[model samples]
Target chain A: MTSSLVLGLELAYWQQSILRSLGILLAVLLPAGTFVYLFLFKMVSFMQSRLGPMEAGPFGSMQLLAEVGKWIQKEDIIPEKADRLLFKIAPYLVVSTVLLTYIVVPFGPDMIFANHDTGIFFALAVSSISTLGVLAAGWASANKFSLMGGLRAAGQLIAYELPLILAVVGVVIQAGTMNMSGIVAAQANGEIFGFDGIGSPYFITQFLGFVIFMIAVQAELAQTPFDMPIAESELVTGYLTEYSGIRFLLFFIGEFAAVGAFGAIAATLFMGGWAVPAAWADLNNNIFNLLGPLILMAKMTLVGGFIFFIRFTMPRFREDQLQKLAWTVLIPLSLVNILATTILKVAF
Target chain B: MSEFLRDYLTVAIFAAVAIGLLLVVLALGKLIRPVRPQADKYLTYESGVDAVGTAWDQTPVRYYVFALLFVLFDVEAVFIFPWAIQLETYGWFGAIEMSVFIVILALGLLYAWRKKVLQWL
Candidate 1:
């Protein structure tokens, strides 16, 4: 069935797979986005040593619900001077751009949608377009802060985008494939110091590269130590200063969605998304293939927790510092990482 | 998809569904919620004061310079991509191409640094 379908481009299977992938993606996205938002919302309040939404529904989890309810019913305000078309279009654009990146992410064993040969690149390219949505949102608001924020986003995204790609290149070199599952598979089959496959993890194989990747990802997500564009005190919530109510909700969803997307991607590439750790190789027999996939999710959730931990702990960087890191440190490091990767390919 | 085609299809389908679902949720929210737009509420105001002054705000030229320098480097950085991609097969040739590319990239950085642009930020 698989071979013959392949020969004929089986439209039914293609259609079915597409539908199934969509269902799976929605399934992952809803839960992932909700998880990140709820986790952060709680963490933020918890750090202040105050009780968060602990009454709404069994633990104040329904706080997001009440808040979302209030936002939805709130008056939709449009500034008379605002560019109306762009104003209406901006939020949806930003929101769409942010969540559209989940197509290539592998959630469990062979569970990715549209597993492109260029899965890594596909994710990168799609996510890159989100900056445009951000930029548009800023420009359309017809406010100076919004414009500045938009410009900042454009600069920041364009600036750090290279280092991000370069670090991913190192992973590609080590894994010997660009497809994400392939990267995870490489981790699964990686040499463990020749003791019948007992080599160190990819992090050990390419320590510098891993650091570069992590920092670049931090920059890409505009997280702590790189979050200049949205520095609330400086630009007044950056591009979102003028947005209110449901529109504000859209922007909010977009931001948290990115956290989930990046978390999933990082898990797939570096932390071995759904792939099991080395000690569990004996469990790779036919009967345990199912368990192998669960191991991958466990790893993903672990990484997601760490990301939330960092968010709660770190402080934002100044715009100058953000640019400096991108241009001076990240760009140079990216170039050198590429150089090392090429040398490793040739010499090793 | 023989193992190969399934992979590509997976991505395409997933992308469509995530985006579709997000829109659905958002649109559903709008449909269910009652929107009330008041004439006075829509008035342009800063800090709750009305008709204080024109909305055109001032910004430093330095940020523009930062963006300009950023664009130049970003475009140049893309050059390394093709070479890095073929590194496994091109080996020494790819390495040499990359070195030359890096040299030019380094010079661009040098130009930015000498002009004290990075210092400005």
Candidate 2:
């Protein structure tokens, strides 16, 4: 049952746990830092015809470090009227949920933090815990803008949560397993209408579900076009208005880390996770344990880049329009996608 | 301990690690960061204007309604997950049965929509 090993060495469970802990840290922070530097800074700047930070380290690569340095020395602030304890504890809740999400994601055949049976379900369930932290921050801040932003975030998240959950149902039906590793195995073994050249990535068949999932993810992250909660023009950065210094840094990291986490999930679900095409490599080969994380990271970059590209390009959706899109459009479409997938599953 | 429990232990350990890491960073911040406090600085930010009314005022009831709708669908989604995994074994019977279940819920959503419960106002 000891599924993880480095090189040829067999390690004890405590050793494995330590390794896994470090892996989880690397998995979460690397992508968070990558997305911040690549998409948030460099890509957006290039799109806007301006060079982003080039002074930090080779094209502002060290900008994240600089930002961290700057944020750490600043004062941590809590308003006089705020519920001091909840306001202080809120960022922990948000960032921890983001960290918890990485637990279920399979970085390699053996390189998962925790191999839960209900992997995707567990990830989805824990991810929503951030909403509670958000509400707590808003309520405790006792600021009008914070309250409105928090409530709007709650509404937006809940509305999109359905589509997000339902969209995965189509993939679940196709793979016939809720386990993250199992789903990756299915894709690696799957053939598109008897053609096994490219192992069937769910995105080809679950394209509708994929689209819905991405849209819901955008809304969940409160990215543009669905960023009413954090809409600066309106709510003044929403629930985040009251936070400062290290607490604000925690939320910022959580946001990008979440982007990384969701990007990893999407890559696993729609792309063939860490495995190359079955025709190319035997998935059971131990080589995957080494190459898998790198492959997954590349896929995550692709997915994260797309998400940020859309965030920068789209105009913010009106509040009513946002709710209407989730309820009327995304939900129904995802439900229909489930029905179609189920029918096809049975028919075949 | 059972392997199943071990799996969860890893999760708990990771959670602790995450919190520990955050605390370490926060402690580091506390050591280096200056805490120059001013009375005005502690006041709630209101875009350079003096505060008006308290923010604890009543919010729109629409958010509550949406929460109710979310609960209904969220429960439905939970039920769907197990069915989705077991669909192949259940075959057409499961497909048809779940279709009926989904349609019924869809009808509920439609009812809410028609009644304008989903409106943001």
Colliding residue pairs in candidate 2: none
TM-score of chain A of each: 0.87, 0.96
Local distance difference test scores for all models: 0.70, 0.91
What is residue B71's positional error in candidate 1, in angstroms? 4.5
- lDDT of residue A257 for candidate 2: 90
lDDT tens per residue, model 1, A30-126: 6565665456767667787877778788777777778778887765677777888888778767666566677677665546556666778878888
Listed for every candidate in order, the interface RMSD values in angstroms are 3.3, 1.1
lDDT of 1 at A88: 75
lDDT of 2 by residue, B1-121 (tens): 8978998889888888889889999999999999888999999999989989989987664668878989999999999999999998999899999999999999999999999998877
lDDT of 1: 0.70
lDDT of 1 by residue, B20-116 (tens): 6666766776777766767876665445556544445665546576667666765664655445555778768767877787778778887887888
What lDDT is obtained when candidate 2 is compared to the true structure? 0.91
